[model samples]
Target: MTMFSTIRLRAAAVLASFALALSGCFLSPGKFTSELVFTGPDSFTFSYEGEIFFLGLSKLAQMDAAQAEFTPPECYNQETYESQECSAEELADARANWESGAADRAAEAKKKAEQMAAMMGGIDPSDPKAAEELVKRLKRQKGWERVVHKGDGVFDVSYRVTGTMGHDFMFPLIEGFPATNPFVQTFVRQGGQVRINAPGFATQNPEQAGMGAMMGIGSLAGLAAMRAELDGQGDAMPGIPVIDGTFTVRTTRGMRVLANNTDEGPEPNNTGEALTWRITTRTAQAPTALIALIP
Candidate 1:
């Protein structure tokens, strides 16, 4: 082939690839499957499970508070254990008191459950994924696109994260959905398009000791930190988040790696694009803080 013809063909291929990547940033179906395999130069393969599995895995890593419960006091003391000669009337009274106490506990539990449901916007705590999607939509705006499907409370969306390396990765069709529980969610990313199925949330009943307290605290703290980082980064705006940190963008054949992630305030949002978020990462003490962005 002639040199000019080869050059034209190469240019067309690059343009086509770019368009395909960009188009993947739109909303699509609600329930779908995805498998993303990253093969590196060393034959390294990194596989990601669907969004439901991801959320489930995350839950496994954390603890649930509601399920942890304390053991009831012993039914009998040394004196009671030793003596089996209690009067029939006395035994009957003891049984009556025990039942009354159990009833009271049940009532209190019901009231607490109602209160929690009200606080969560009338959502059931048993559905974690639904809750996660609700929080995401309520908190993060812009990039997400809504898809229309009859009789379905599902949304098709595109979520983009511009890393500190000045590169953007777009997740297309990340569906937002509701389910019985609000904590657990199912998300799928296929061919760059992500779909969300049934998301569920659950709280441990009666609450356990280790998993309940520690996991509850950690999840709260972690989510709070993430929200704060996003809020402070100014990447919440319509511009890309540009940080001076270690960033590596992988392509079909190679990777563009950057270091010294810095978000220069002078950066402005390019309105010509869909949306951008500019963020500056700085180290204060043991934790890192994301500063504001311009434009």
Candidate 2:
């Protein structure tokens, strides 16, 4: 499939994963809040915070209990092909191999546990309270050094990125979507300044402009069919709680704000060295957001 088609498939996979994880608790379309702060010429901080209300506290408790009892099976713990689909004979072979490597696997697991304990400030996994501690840690945001749970299902998370922007800006997506896509434009750094452009909803592109601009009429028709399927499937799903949030961008010191298309929040401020752009919206099945930053 084409890059855009792959991205759409990955988006669908993400939605499917979310649905499975929160199957007990319905989720409504929710808001997604994000913030991008430029700290220096080659450094920036990104934060995304949002909330999804559960039907009741019981759902949250159930989720916590499920995670607390979670453990990797031998197939996952071992570095063997047992994790993959196998024939009956192959499965027997893998089981035998795993049994033979039990000692080595135990050593690896112990080493990994030690590392985890060190990172977690000496919290021993063997302790009775370890499961609870792990549950708390898992509930925190991923990829963020600091994550604050603001109660009522809200969370605030932030992470800093330094050095080159390059392709590092795009985090790994679900299966099918490659890290590189036309929608993600590469940033070029010049002197002390860097410019990046993110496509907006109304942005014009030859591939998506019209049927005449498409590679072929079949491609255009296929895209339409896929979109229709997605819409129908979305409508069929149970209505879940929605989340609404805002995203803001603030330029760092010594950096001049160039141009941005994001809407202003309650207090608009765009006429200074440090400008802000705010976008507030509801989340979707395959959500996509874009922004342009030149510093």
Candidate 3:
């Protein structure tokens, strides 16, 4: 399992505990609490109430991709054969080509991430205005605000999907959090905005029938695992993981609107039609000041 998977398990446990306490359904051994105060030059203050515990982020991008492939049969190609489809000998050649292309993409992503890191430089995390300024910059860049502050633990980031708008927002990490993840989390500001990238999952949501046809080679779970799984294994590969990026804002009240746009997609047919996802996040802390930097 990746460090994130493990953290998710733990975070879930915390939420479970909170749920129990809130319900008064059963007594718990203890109650935990933390206070996050945000202040800004705009004279903003955000305060979080209750025993806040980290909740592992649900990957909206992965979920949407699954939805796109699952609920709509019309969205994907059901054909059994294409040039990409071929005999075992030909499949080998195609696989080699795909792998080469994937490698180039991976190299590019790595370089971009490195360049971003290099631009952040130094900033004191303990500064009183740090969090506020950070949030403001993130909003300006339209980046993610899915952050998990674990006191002295590593800062976990969950970025929003690249293409999602409003509530339809989804997240596809640059790389999904590893089963064993670690980081010296920092924020980067550029061109009056902030940029952030999170780990992502690699997967393919082929038509069920089409996908099942190849399952004899490896299970769906195996194929969806990650790049590490495909390194030396002789199994079919999964699609490259989706990367999510976003702009986020902190609100004085928990209420927030990740305003949906007409450009998002074809509008819903009616109130009952499938709805487009909007990407929005609510932090435990009320935003005291808006920060528009990258994460």
Each candidate: RMSD? 23.4, 15.1, 19.8
lDDT digits (tens) for residues 1-295 of candidate 1: 0012232332233222222212111111222222222233222111111121122112211222222333222232344343234455655665666566765655654654444444334544445554464546433544333222121223222332222212222233233422222221222222232221111111111123222231231122222233234457542211111111121112232321112132431122222111111211221111111211211
- Of 1 and 3, the candidate ranking higher by lDDT: 1
lDDT value, candidate 2, whole model:
0.36
Candidate 1 TM-score versus the reference:
0.23
1 or 2: which has the higher lDDT?
2
Measure candidate 1: CA RMSD.
Answer: 23.4
- Residue 100, candidate 2: Cα error in Å is 50
Which segments of model 3 are wrong by more than 4 Å? 1-44, 48-86, 119-295
Which sections of candidate 1 miss by over 4 Å? 1-94, 124-216, 219-295
Residue lDDT tens for model 2, 177-265:
12322211225454454444422101112233432232221121222233334556663222222223454555544455444444432
Q: TM-score of predicted model 3?
A: 0.21
lDDT sort, best first: 2, 1, 3
- Of candidates 3 and 1, the better by TM-score: 1
TM-scores, in order shown? 0.23, 0.34, 0.21
Residue 244 Cα positional deviation in candidate 2, in Å, after optimal superposition? 2.8
* lDDT assessment of candidate 1: 0.27
Candidate 3, 170: how far from true, in Å? 24
